[model samples]
Target: MSTTISTVALGDDIAALPRARPAPPARRRPPLKLAALWPRVRGWLLAWPVPLAVLALWQLAASYQWIPAQILPAPLTVAATFVDLFNTGELQSNTLISLQRVLFGFLTGAVLGLALGVAMGLSPLVKDYLYPTFKAFAQVPSLGWLPLLMMVVGIDEALKIILIAKSTFVPITLNTYKGLQGVPSSYIEVAKVYGFNRWQMLRRVVLPAAFPPIWNGVRYGLTHSWLALVGVELLASSEGLGFLIVYGRQLYQLDVVLAAVVVVGAVGYALDKILALIEARLLRWRRDAF
Candidate 1:
């Protein structure tokens, strides 16, 4: 009877002790749709303030004529001129021509750069023989080559394309060689342990490892190509966005010049964004790998 009472007392004591008060039901998260959208909204909010402020300042400046109208046209005036050029199809035609030149030249330069970079990266003998001359060649700007090239290729499409290609080729080749050289020795050792043949090693290991840098090179190459195209057009062409700028300046139409400049900036930004999207898509695996 005493033992039973003691057991009952112990149970009573245990029951009297404080309970954890089940962790206040975990606070529910916001809905998935709201969660996903908030970041983009936040990003826009952060991004717009500076640009909006600049636009407002520009408008104020133009309205007050703080800068001469002939030098710094109003934003509205530039927008109107842009619309006019678009309506008359001048903008479209010139932009198309510029795009064609960049695409052709970029492709040509990229292929050759890849071939040469790969060869040099794989063979010390080739690198030793070619790298010195290539470095010296790259030190000279595209404009520096213009006179010599014009003398040889003449003032034609060939001249512009060659100049653009030259601008692209250097970055692509340098980046590709550096990227390949940077691949970790451990990766090569692992591949060797796995008995990966040369082809397999290159295809499965080297390229993937070096892809980010290679892609960077490609992006920079495209940018350089675009810049080179504009420069070549400004110097020699009769019909391109660069020509539009030249025509505007010749007529002393600051608005037209501003409009063409805006188009050039917008197009370049769009191209870069497109490339960024592609890079993100291609590199998705890196996120998972880590």
Candidate 2:
């Protein structure tokens, strides 16, 4: 009878205990649309508002003669000038010439800069000998070299190319050096423990770590080269986009000058966009690249 009473008490205690509750159902997300996949496209479209507003204000100013037409030129007039230049193929020829010059200069400078940067980065002795001189030379602007380049290379294609190359070289070398310097000592130690040869170490460890800054330098170098090319052309050449601006000015055609300026800005923007696309594709592995 006591055992029965104890069993009854145990059963009552078990019934008094709280039971486990079931989990709520998982949320079901909506399927993504095609447009939803490309956030960059939306970002790019959003960027047009500022430019469009500026353009609208410019047109308004032109319509009201807020600025003298002789100096500012109406947007419509500039458009007409662009159409004329395009039909004549003059714009195309000049643009092509400028692009070719920049490409040649950029390639040469990038190659040489990479070599010099790697040398200085890897060798303390080379850095000690060359870095100070390079920094000093780099303090001088691209146009500052024009006079010396004119004396040495003359007012020819060679002079323009050399100046552009110099503009490109400085940023690339500096960035490459900085990138190499920032590589983790721990990474190098690990590489050493793994018995990596010099080439293996550079290929497997250094290049990956240094690529981001190096790529940034290359982008900046390209921009510098373009600007330097225009400056060189303005000072010396008779057949490039800069000369088109000078020629328009000489003829008192503000519209022509504005048209040329527009082309210059458009081309530069296009170059940057191209470089950005290339960077994005190549560095997709990076967390914050581009």
Candidate 3:
């Protein structure tokens, strides 16, 4: 009877204990796409001072004999090299050649990409026929095509231009296709309600909406094409900045290599900034609408 009473007492104590409540559902944080890109903008703002600082530091180190001068020339040496090359007209010629190649290649590729993208967006048959094949092509890096291109074009200006064009074409085509495909149904409905015919709907409703993304793709394509152009030039060329780097390496002049690198980076940054300016102007509607 005592054991039975003790068991009943333990049961009462266990029944009196509190049970745990389930955890409250976690609240999801909102997306911060634009704001997350703010840090990159800030870094861009800080970029101009970097090269200057590097120059000053290098000059100080070289003057103090902290390292061999040939290994890392003072910024003054690089400047003198620059001035000498400029006066000799070699720099001007090489730069012009590179610019011409870029212009020819980029314009050709961008036009084709735009046309192809439009066809894909408008014609289901074309999309089904081309997109899968295009996706496979995109998997091959630009550098991977260099040997094949050289065999066909024989390491001449044509090879460089063709490589640049290929680098530009794929991204532009892909982005443009996506941009057109993603236009909201609401916009189409509004156009229809306003009695827009097919051409009217496309021109007034679709084109403007798609332009910004298409332009962005072109900007990226330009960047990639420039990089590919440099690689191609480095491998086989008599002129251009890529050739400049290769020439410097062959002559064992680190200063010239560094100078060429600086030039390439500066040119790329300038191109991007120009594109950004254009984007801001053309997409003013985005600022208002968003």
Candidate 4:
């Protein structure tokens, strides 16, 4: 009778305890479209603030006349000048000419740089014989060579191309040589252990290892070529974006100068971005390998 009483008390105590409630329905996520779109939107959001702030500051300065309009024209004035140039087809033609020169010069320099770099990297004798002369040559700015090059090639397309190529060549050759030299000795040893021949070793081990720096060189080479092209145009050519800047300054049309400057910056940024995309694509394998 006592045992039954105790059991009944225990049952009552159990019944008095709170029951477990079900979890609230899993919170629903937003649609997949929105999820994917967020990243791109976020990227733009992150990128836009600086430029927007600069624009605001520029507008403020213009409105307040903090700087003379003649020296630093309003942003809108520059935009109008850009539009006018575009309408006249002057901007497009000049831009195309600059692009052509950069491409031609960059290609020429890149090819020669690759060859020279590879030779120096692979052959000690070649490096020893050429490095001193190359270093001295590189020390001289492209402009320093102008007087001599002008005498040799005259003030023509050849002169501009040679200056641009020289500008490109130094960086490319240096990077390529360093890249090749930087490859791990262990990697070469491993390749040799696997019986890799010269071609096989280079193709499978050396080139892959060195490619990143070589590609970097190519990108730098292009940038150097662009800078050289602009300098050459400014001093010599009657046509091209650089000349436009000179023309605007001469006429005291600061807006036109700013417009041309804007275009130059935009083009350089775009080219760099293009090269970056290509680099990312080509080096995707590195991500997996690591």
Candidate 5:
């Protein structure tokens, strides 16, 4: 009995003593490297060494006997030819012609596509009436239209412009239609709840929401227009970059052909870059809020 009482007292004394609390956990620090991502990403802007090196290698190969000059012209020869063409104003004139064709045709196509796509996207009647034919037309390669269109329009600028319009039209129409149609039903409901009139809904709600995709369509249209213009010129025209390529071939000047090809690629890249910049600027708000 005495031992048990002593043990109980000892336990009570231990329980009465204050216990130490676990030390508060040390605060964790976020990693510093995460803040440096943007600079690293920006580093991509300076990574042109690879492509420049490749061009240098190509120039060297053609300058020497590694590749026959006749088959593959030296970079220097191409540069000289480009300079000559530029100096004589042949390059400028031909480029202007192509630009005019693309501009006129693309404008026409964009206007028509926007109208038609907006109508069709809004109304099932228009969609049902137009979609099948549009899809059919879109499926046929732009090159295939060359022969038939040439018959009616002939080997003139008119034919080339018309062909480019055809190429630009389909994608623009399809993408615009899709973009407008893709507007959420929830948005429509909100517009309705706010008692917005049809015109107001179209101007304020549908267009702004659909603008991005429509812009994408326009970008695609420009690209196709360039390609079609090239094809038409190559097939049967006396001027433009495509014809320059043909002209070079007829005279056995592969360097001219190569130079012309390089110009085409560079122009296309420039257009794409321009469009990308536009897209980025337009979507700046979306990027920020998201």
Candidate 6:
């Protein structure tokens, strides 16, 4: 009986010995509180106040005849004209032409600007010889070149393209040169310590460091090119969005003019937003106050 009692005691002690407990089922993380994003939503909503006020004022003026109907058509009239032009494909065609001009001009100008800029940045002699001349040439507005360009290139697509390209070239060249020059000395020293060759140093150190300012230059170049294209079209072209504006005015149809103006503004805004989005994505490595 004592042995049995001892055996039973031994069994109880063994059972009481700590055994690994299965981990309490992992506590699940709570889902993100989407409701907490209300502030951001409110902020975006608040941004519309200015545009809304402008629209309201515009409508009130149209209703009260504060401005002559011929000079400033009702917003509704402009909206209707926009719809008509869109449905007829008139707006699309003109916009497409303008976009094509910009694309060709911008690409050509960017490539040339980048080459010259890199050369100038890399060689002091090139900068000394070319930089001053470029500055002087750039000081003249794109329109100022239009008359001379027309005389040489004629009032054709080539004229518009060249002017747009010139507009794009100046800003990009300056920015690229400045950006490359602005790269930190420490980065160059580090590259040298790593025994980087010229190509490796430029690719691994210079390009990344210079990209932000170069991108800014590209943005400005595009904006300037668009403006230049429109101005050229207004001055010389028979077709394009700018021509549409001129045609509207000549016909005394303010609605058409306003519609074209609105489209230009919208397209410009859209392009800027697109570039901004791309810039943000590419520069995710950058830390900033915003």
- Lowest summed-lDDT stretch of 10 residues in model 2? 281-290
Which lDDT tens digits does candidate 6 get at residues 1-290?
99999999999999999999888898898886768778889999999999999999999999999999998888899999999999999999999999999999999899999999888988999999999999998899989987788789899889988989999999999999999999999999999999999999999999999999999999999999999988988989998999999999999999999999899988988998999999998998786535
Q: How close is candidate 5 to the true structure, as a TM-score?
A: 0.82
Give candidate 5's error at residue 260 in angstroms: 1.3
Relative to the true structure, how large is the alpha-carbon lDDT of every model? 0.92, 0.92, 0.87, 0.93, 0.89, 0.93
Off by over 4 Å in 5: 1-50
As for TM-score, the candidate ahead, 2 or 5, is: 2
CA lDDT, candidate 5, residue 157: 81
Off by over 4 Å in 6: 1-43, 287-290
Which portions of model 2 show Cα errors greater than 4 Å?
Answer: 1-42, 287-290
Q: For candidate 5, write residues 1-290 as lDDT tens digits.
A: 99999999999999999999999999999677855786776677567778899998998898677988888888888899999988999888888887888899888888888888888999999999999988988999888988898889788888887888888898899999999999998999999999999999999899889989999999999999899989889998998899999999999999889888988888888987899998999989888998
Clashes of 2: 0
Error of 2 at 28 (Å): 17
Using lDDT as the measure, name the better of candidate 2 and candidate 3: 2
Q: How many residue pairs clash (N, CA or C atoms closer than 3 angstroms) in each of the candidate models, in the order given?
A: 0, 0, 0, 0, 0, 0
**TM-score for each model:** 0.86, 0.84, 0.80, 0.84, 0.82, 0.86
The digit string of per-residue lDDT tens for model 1 on 94-125 reads: 99999999999999899989888888888899
In model 5, the clashing pairs are: none
Residue pairs clashing, model 1: none
Q: Please state the error at residue 58 of candidate 5 in Å.
A: 1.3
Q: Model 4: per-residue lDDT, tens digit, 88-115? A: 9999999999999898899899999999
Task: Give candidate 5's whole-model lDDT.
Answer: 0.89
- The lowest-lDDT stretch of 10 consecutive residues in candidate 1 is 22-31
